[model samples]
Target: MGWLFLKVLLAGMTFSGLLYPLLDLSISGKTRAPKPNIVIILADDMGWGDLGANWAETKDTTNLDKMASEGMRFVDFHAAASTCSPSRASLLTGRLGLRNGVTHNFAVTSVGGLPLNETTLAEVLQQAGYVTAMIGKWHLGHHGSYHPNFRGFDYYFGIPYSHDMGCTDTPGYNYPPCPACPQSDGLWRNPERDCYTDVALPLYENLNIVEQPVNLSGLARKYLEKAVAFIEQASTSGRPFLLYMGLAHMHVPLSVTPPLENPGSQRPYRASLQEMDSLVGQIKDKVDHMAKENTLLWITGDNGPWAQKCELAGSVGPFFGLWQTHQGGSSAKQTTWEGGHRVPALAYWPGRVPANATSTALLRYCSIPTVELLESMGACRLSAWTITRPSTLLGEPKLVMGARVLSNSTLPLSFSTWKTMLQKLRPYREEAPSTRRCCQRSPGFLQMSFKTLLMTTAPERTTLRTLR
Candidate 1:
């Protein structure tokens, strides 16, 4: 009888798994989610061990832990670039920074913008009949050719760029000496451009601006509401959907809030993070309500915190340059030390991705190509695939960084190789982190650049220019 019961249990599990596609296609009148509806929840500038699941022993992060237990954790996930615009460009294009001419932030300087020819994840999904909508920050571009509408998103609703960008070309939407032109009544203007406020909100429904979002503390609820509506609509229409919800929290002016605003804010060190966790909880509830175990959810950060803000403003936490430097590299100052590039990365899918599967596998953001996703839906064939760094291909006239630099390519180390790299890099590893000891192991293809060290006036600052 016990054996028979075991057999029945196996049969039940098998039946459920197999029934998913048939029921989804037939009764529901919709195609099964192709490789799951991908949701990349990009946090602003959180740390490597900030999540509860990653540092449960010391830190008090609950919601993130629950997520890890139910999904897969990429112990070694990497960002495309160290900053937001370039990093995001790398993600959407599936190419490294240089190829897209956006290796730097677009706010302060004009060094980067998404390329025109590059196909976006939305366009790919749209081709395969997946509804694509961006519900958060759209920092990629602001103009016609470069906007999300042009890139691939069928629907777009989010802030144009960083809230911290210098004041706009026009003030108060119009009036006294509009920077250059009075523009028109159609343009947007916010007085809180340099400060934090819930008023000067930037809101979009589809292509039209419906309202200006205020009180970012409630941004999560807004996204969740939109996501739920989208999922419901997709469920009714019987087509797969891709939802990219980027949150703008744990980043900014750092004001205290209610429990709902910051769930885990009790700890002085990472209060905003706790609030962010609350936002995560709301998202999870919506997913469960939709019963989207077949959906894929990927969460990560935009870039390291404002290093200077961390130092002077008391907003950013411990990450070296989270508040200051354009982007603090993963590990250390100037180089891909792991502090900036190797921050938090998590993926979860119900009834699909193996639960508790903590993958140390070297995963790059560029790997999520639109074609691959479409292929899963039997909608497209692999015409071609190239993994070149975009920033290098289009921009940088001199291209002096990588070509003339001539740095040794260091592969990610295992238990043994890491020890060797550590021994080789010992002089600079002294001030790594106050908590965990640096592991002797790294990703398989982990490489370090000598340019940072070689350029610094002294060998003491050799670690300044580590590679990403």
Candidate 2:
């Protein structure tokens, strides 16, 4: 009997030893890490059909398609607003633009700045013990008060608004290229030029101008390099970070890759998209190579795709009933149509979020904060946001119509418009900085040469201090 009891006890011990590791893993899976890095890549005006992963007939984006294959995608993601500034407002404050006092582009210059009353995601993330950085277009505001530096980003780079929004019809020091030239009508041009700060299209680092009216591609590479460095830094320091990469592509004067430019049609757009995909691939490889599979990476466009029509570029897909009282131009390109807001979204955290996990939870650009995204990370609580109301959090849909929440202005508040808005929006928000005060002001030189740095080796980083 003693011998039999001894055998049973030894067997139980063996079994427990084998199960111990598995039990620990199960418990850890439910717990939060000290901190995890977050990467949000925002593509401008890219459409639902534009991605190779989607069923778009003309566009071709292979790397993006591959990402979709490797990760999960939401067919119904949305943008905060159709236009750049409003959308940016929604992204930053997690509230509708109307809530912040913006309704239309009619008096865009005077009204569209991101109000100081509201806190931005950058500020929230920074307060949560994460480093933040913003790269690409910042269409929220231009005044010193509305500038990115004051909004919570520790570092800032990229354009202040739409590439051509500020381009003038007049050709002079402070003016734009001659609109008199017929070539200007339907031509590809950079709105970035020398301004009071530096060149109008200058590269801004924090509050200083790093380069004058610089080319976006060069700046994009610099931004990416800095982001990668930030990742390395974050990993080494054991602090979580939020890296926002705003890509200026598939939008403008139709700047396609040279190969695609030869075709100068949808194909050019395809090429540009593919290039952007390649850049994404580069970032992904870097992160996966450097960190464990637990890091979260999210990629999506800011709004709908734009199509080139006679002289203006607007939405590509058929997005009906998008314009409100003050906004216009075309259907979905900037409208509230599904094509306008139904941009693509992909999230990945190999070990955490289930691979190929298709979440149709009706994600809105402004609702990201309500996703318990920060809480899941053990971050601080956020104050009131228009999107994260009690109803929405309780598995109920927030009625998304009516006037601006903060401004008290009327809007085209209707179910159809709301549906269109929800269907068309993508996963985008104004980027918060990854770290405070990282980008020293720079003096940029874009016109020195126009050759693209793409198809070149990876950027290892060089001194841009002299440019400033």
Candidate 3:
């Protein structure tokens, strides 16, 4: 039987001094103090096929392609969810969206936000003596305890939610509104749940509102400018930093600098993608110049494109989405298909990450803290706790949410030790109530096996896959 599995991965530094304890400590006795700087460039609604390395027809992403070739390319990396708010919640907390109470996007009128009780990656890194800054879209929550600054980031700058909202002129706040749709003062309420009314979108600097109805055309450039400044400030302070550039580009209402918007060659949407590539290159150049060997850089999309937007939303490569179909099945940004959450990830850490390596290992955004803690070599710890409050029935079909206790586990400092333990546990699977087993073969780059049980009424639907 063909086993279906989720591929998760974490990139380690290639530094000889810090390499031993992370992967396999028995191989070497040396351990260096880790103070590596981290920069996460998160693209909004970009697809796996949007990169030049993944799909040729899209704009050339020379910098990202170069980064992928230089460091490690994760072919099977996945976000926790297909949509923005939920996926972002999972990315930061390592818990599923349902568990975090952020199962859907937060509308301006909506009272929901990422629960303040959950621990974010920023909080973990902050405790580790690293400065953290957040730039760009922060859909987690717009107000109160859920704001970025309140969450963990020492500095926050960007919009509170998606860009396509809060427009008085655009009907339903739909950019390039459908001509056929009737337009009357354009104040029509959006059909989607958890979305706000068409009010002017505001840009925030920390907790204060800086710009209302922000100039959508120059948002990307603004995000980049803030990111570079943060990097420079952190680098000059001689402190380890986490620069989280949550870019707002390649999403709907595509915008770019005039020079990049060559009408004949690159469409506005494609230009936005290219512009993002340039931003990535700029960040890499800065990092290389400042501390090439002491920094770990990551570039990836939050999730797949909004298939409903057609070419404006970008491409998802071989995978399918909500509006797009491949063969006989359908997959899209809001679904559980690979095209929805499987995004392209590029990790570059000079000397530590192998050159031009591709890893098919199962990697999820939730494992980010694992990577952060492991990369820092116990320089930080994720404090695990839970709150058992009354469940809030949210999302479609109204299901119970939150109020579950979380048990935390840590990865061993030795890979071989963990591998042996996994092997020993393989034999006990048959005796257990649920089905579970390790794979017979390992994968290229880095390999780790995980067992999964599929509970279903149909016997044929029940199966497992090799995670490695």
Per lDDT, the best of the predicted structures is 3
What's the CA RMSD of model 3 in angstroms?
Answer: 17.4
Top-TM-score candidate index:
3
- Cα lDDT of model 1 by residue, 1-468, tens digit: 999999998789768796576555575425433444566678766665566444433244577777877766654555655567776776675455555566666653343358787656666667766778887777887656777777778777777676444232212211111232224555545453353222243566666776553444455567767877877776567677777777766454342244333434344336656667777776776766774655667787655544444321212122333222334333331235445665566766666555654544443221222243333433211111111111111111121221110012122221212113222333222222333244433322122111110122222322211211
What TM-score, over all chains together, does every model reach?
A: 0.62, 0.62, 0.67
Candidate 3: worst 10 consecutive residues by lDDT?
397-406
User: Each candidate's lDDT (Cα)?
Assistant: 0.51, 0.52, 0.61
Error of 3 at 342 (Å): 1.2
Off by over 4 Å in 3: 1-34, 168-197, 259-265, 321-330, 364-468
In terms of lDDT, the poorest run of 10 residues in model 1 is 384-393
Note each model's CA RMSD in angstroms: 15.6, 16.8, 17.4
Residue range 1-468, candidate 3, lDDT tens digits: 123222111222444345546556653335535577878888888888787655545446878877877776654556767788887776676556656687788877766689887777777667667899999988898868888998879999998888765542222212445212224556556566223445767889998988866766667778878888888899999888988877877666666665453455756666777788998999899899988888878887778888777667777765543222534444557766657777878777777655665554343111222332334343211111011111111111111111011111111111221112223232211111122223222211111111110111123322121110
In lDDT terms, how accurate is model 3? 0.61
- Candidate 2, residues 185-250: lDDT per residue as tens digits? 354534453222212444677888776445533444676687788778877777677777777775
Name the 10 consecutive residues with the lowest summed lDDT in model 2. 445-454
